[model samples]
Target: MQYSQKVLDHFMHPHNVGKLENPDAEATEGSPACGDQVSIFMKVDENTHKIQDVKFLSYGCASNIATASIITDMAKGKTIEEAKKITWKEAAEELDGLPPVKMHCSVLAVDTLRKAIKDYEIKHGLAEEDKFSTDKIIEELKKVIYPNVGEDIVSLKMVKYVGFKDGTAIVDVEIPKFDKYRDNVAEEIREHLEKFKEIKDIKITM
Candidate 1:
């Protein structure tokens, strides 16, 4: 895959790559088992609700590190509300564009930043924790990118069904039998859903 000069530059010399001491908020997203994870830390100005400083730690490929680095730079001086608006698509575009297969790295980076902002909000009583439900599961599924197209499975109409009963979550997806990313899609689903403590087990059917 040919990466843009911007992507290579960020990957070779990432910005804001480290943990912030005594961060007012922090969050970690993704799973190492799936080969990518990002942790974000932030210091916020209570009065202005602005991110005074931001940093990240990434574990994965060059795309992962580059995405996290760029995300931190984007969030550094933005208010929590402003940072919340940073989407994966915007992050990818900021880097001049990421390959379709590597698009999820931008998702992970933005998700981590948003999670950190949420942490800050909840800690400061600025927001309340959202109750988990089947709807939440579906929302999370939207984060699962189809590597082949760099679009979410939900948006791609690949997700056929979603249900939750008792302690188990069930998902039905439609992927061609020979699709190279079939396993990757399933794993991504599991990683996204597993974070919900309400889910004791997951059943994915293709």
Candidate 2:
């Protein structure tokens, strides 16, 4: 497929390439089996709480690697709060535009950034209220039944990410590139979580 010019540039000469030293927060993410993985390291100036340096290591397709490079570049010099606002859309825009099928590369970058921030927050003992519904309900459910495993609808690691807006809830799930079985896992979880009127939107992502 012929990628957009910007995509080609990023793929060919990614920015902010390398790893940071003694970073305040670091996170490794991606599906190793799928051959897409990224590790992000960031250093924050203690007094300012601004990211002073950032780096990444990635093993993936061109878009995935390029997105990681872009995210690290964007995070540098920005406050943690500012960095959190950098969305997948911004990453895609930076790359001009990615093919629809490769769009997940951008989402992966965004999720990795979140995971890194969460790691930093955890390390600092910053226990603020979760922005979204992360009630341990999912944990309890895991014990009772896994999402899509054990030849049962209840045993799989089906849920990927969940977001909320007001009372609307959005859930994202990974569709197995090989199996059709997990396709409806998100819907089932949505149905279960929708029991409360507080949930206004339940999104199934695959």
Clashes of each: 0, 6
Clashing pairs in 1: none
Residue 27 of model 1, lDDT score: 97
Give per-residue lDDT, candidate 2, residue 16.
74
lDDT (Cα, 0-100) at 179 in candidate 2: 62
The residue-by-residue lDDT of candidate 2 on 177-204, one tens digit each, is 6665454444345545654566776666
Best by lDDT: 1
Instruction: State TM-scores per candidate.
Output: 0.97, 0.64
Stretches of candidate 2 exceeding 4 Å from the true structure: 128-206
TM-score of 2: 0.64
lDDT of each: 0.93, 0.67
Give me the overall lDDT of model 1. 0.93
Residue 163 in candidate 2, Cα distance off native in Å: 14
